[model samples]
Target: MDMGGLQIEQDGQTLRILLSGVWGLPSAAGLDRRIAAIHAGGVRHAVIDTSGLERLDTAGAVLLHRLWRRLAAQGAKVEWPAPRPEYRTLFDYVADSGEGKVIRPPKESGALALVAWVGWLTLFFLREARRFIAFIGRVAESAAKVALQPRRLRLTSMVHHMEEAGLRAIPIVGLLSFLIGVVMAYQGADQLRRFGAEIFVVDLIGISVLRELGVLLTAILIAGRSGSAFTAQIGTMKVNEEIAAMRILGLDPVEILVLPRMFALILTMPLLTFYADIMGLFGGAIMAWSSLNIDLNLFAQRLQDAVSLKTFFVGLVKAPVFAALIGMVGCYEGLRVKQDAASVGRLTTRSVVQSIFLVIVVDALFSIMFSIMGI
Candidate 1:
């Protein structure tokens, strides 16, 4: 029931603050107001006498700490002459833990803030590019070593990742690719019907799906799924210091972790792409039959004429390259992860985004190269 209060008295150049009553949560509001009303502008020395305090808790301890800092900042040298044994530990904890510090926001940078931000971003990009190049070199060197001694390849880990990244991805990839095919056919038929060439919808679906969408969509799915998984798994290991332990024991973390996932993706991506192509074609053919009244035979026959071996191989060749990018980026970000749970999540998201972006870029480059080559 006792309200906390402080009485300040000044004598010449010195100030004294004597605290009394129950200094707890219930009295925190009154104490704060009272402290705020004090004027310590030019006092050279101040003594805080806590002997009159009837009770104290963490909340009151924090307020006392705040008051002490406020007076010090106002040009007064503050001192707590003799804190009681019961309050010493709490007061020491509050002071040492910086419970009274105020965090100020950064000053405004005005109109030039955008330019400064752009410059900082450019620098960050260049630095990350250098690190990525170095990471790729290390991966290539490790790959060459494994290629020389095939026995060093960890087949167990490779198989596990293959099942994870490839076999298990079949359902979602197949379903989505099939749906993409259906939508593409339906739209193509609607457009071609205007020109009295609904039958050409077969050519549209076959060439597009076999040559582009099937592999591209499948790679995107894998990047979001398997690529992010790689980052999270390895980042978590790094956070737990498991990666460091591997190095300490003379084991290569790159060889043991990165190479296996990389090789698994390289081996499985092409096969998954092929599966996606078949599923896509099947969906397109079904829609073609339903919408354009084209039978399975006619659809298949036209598909053969529209999509050649070159077309299929063109898309197929890009699968390994895309897989390598996804695997390398994912593992690279994972290895770069700092020792924290938050870093794992952040780097995992970065891995997925970077992998997808690089995949799309590489696909575009491939398209340009194939065009120039007249294939």
Candidate 2:
């Protein structure tokens, strides 16, 4: 059987066209050739007979409408013979909806557009901050409840997340800290050698690594690694409607999901920061002994004299706060994900970026506070 076809005939000034079979996307190419041939004929007036059409769809209706408009534009009157009511309705709907109109973007001045964009961004930032604070409060309340009734704590989930976020992260964190220590020592030695202050390179390495670099770098790494993972995992759950199902089953997702992860990160961060400090000091010691003629014993002595317990505590004190920030930001972005795969990826990236930014800002604030307190 013929799938679809268009036939045209002309008698003097009037052109009669017959549409047959199914008219849809599959038949569009052939219909286009036929329409083009008819247009080339320069027929003045046209009548489209759809009574012969076995099936008509939006695609076919759109093509027919285009032909009608073309004829009308060229000083020709186009008419449609009495057809099935459904086909007529479909044709009229497609034609009158202005689907074929070209949409042009509105023009605006650069300065005005910039101002509008900035205002929108400021409002969005404020809204996000409010939502984040509310989420934190909910998490805190759930955590307090768990603390009062320790049995309610998801110990197994917390342990699992601890292994994933902390244990699994050690190698990368250690290696990066070690490398940073080496670079810092080498650079310090080079600068100090010019002033006959090479021995002070040990002081520089110990103070900087213990007080700033170790905890800060570790937090940044955790933010990128575990933070992004948390967002992606929860976002996937959101996309799959698992969160909704949990709610329907009377489960609080915050207690089950967010609190455990938050607790795990908090418990593990101080330990990780201490481990990073040790590894970084070891790396710097190696560089100092090899390059600056400062043996391991001499380097140890200088480090002991240069870095105080207060300096060590200053870095460790920031670890739990940084971990909390990373965990909250990651889980928050994950829960914010919409029901789409693209949203999962987008929010996961956003989680890592936002967590890192907030961690740095918080670290700077701690630095100011420490300086003021003379710690």
Candidate 3:
């Protein structure tokens, strides 16, 4: 029967599709309806005959591919006759594309589905953990090599990343720390005033900020800021196929891209933590003087007497470790990005989340170790 620009004939269990005239964009709507209406029931085999076609463009090729898939889905084996060279190329290109094809897992329900989901999640987590460890090993190896041959290190890139991740982050980090200190002092003063120990707020702010909050908060902020930036930056490069090009050119992505950002964060995190500590104390001092009626001079003396070198160093020591975690997770997720804008966006968000989670977990482990050692 004639169906617009094509004809369909059934002989026994075999179905044949015949094409003629123009099958380009103009006739696409009619072609779709006619192709969809073809009777494939009880048919075991189908063949596409393209010899009668006068013209076929990309849109036509796509529609033809769709028809092939539709017939196959109905349990009929679809075959295409060899057409012109140009037709073959267009058909192959359209068929090979991943856009229109979707692979979905079989559906399950009830307890079995829950169990399967849990199993899948467990496997996913374990796989991700393995990859992270492997990435860390690669970074360590590259870092050792760079250390031995200092000339190979990208000092200019390191400094540039430092300015980007460190210098630019100061205002927000300092502002947040200062606000936290003010809130801490205000709350601590209010609580302690009932027992006539409003002056002890100095010790509270000094110990809490220096021993924990300063570095912890700074690392968290950096994870959300610079960590996401690293992912988006590298992810975009991957989407553009720049990383593959770099590999072809014999350039190490780890050395050129990862190390500079990681080392920059490592060097700058401690400085940022120190600055955070200072701003935190200054804010506490201000609050103490204004709310608790404690003199600024007395506040300074109390802060000096309360927090020791060990307390300050305790927080500083965690900075590099947190920085490494953040930078590595970001770059790792970025490198894992697929060649699409959606993958870039998805992995950038995942990088920030993973970096923050890892930072907190490591911080807790450090806290336990420090406590056990009585530091």
lDDT of each: 0.93, 0.91, 0.93
Please give the lDDT score for candidate 1: 0.93
TM-score, candidate number 3: 0.73
For model 3, how does the per-residue alpha-carbon lDDT over 257-356 read when each residue is reduced to its tens digit? Answer: 9999999999999999999999998899999999988998999898889889999999999999999999999999999999899998999999999998
Off by over 4 Å in 3: 1-113
lDDT winner: 1
Which tens-of-lDDT digit does each residue in 296-327 have in candidate 2?
99988888898889889999999999999999
Model 3 lDDT-worst window of ten = 1-10
Better-scoring candidate (TM-score), 1 or 2: 2
Name the candidate, 1 or 3, with the larger TM-score value.
1
Q: What is the RMSD of candidate 2?
A: 7.0
Report clash pairs, candidate 2. Answer: none
What would the per-residue lDDT of candidate 1 be over residues 1-375, giving only the tens digit for each residue?
A: 668889988998999999998899998898898888888969999999999999889999999988888898899998888789879888888889879567678886776788898899999989998999999999999999999999989999999999999999999999999999999999999999999999899989988998999899999999999999999999999999999999999999999999999999999999999999999999999999999999999999998888899999999999999999999999999999998899999999999999999999999999999999998
TM-score of each: 0.75, 0.78, 0.73
Candidate 3 Cα RMSD after full superposition onto the native fold (Å): 11.0
Residue 106, model 3, lDDT:
86
Clashing residue pairs found in predicted model 3 = none
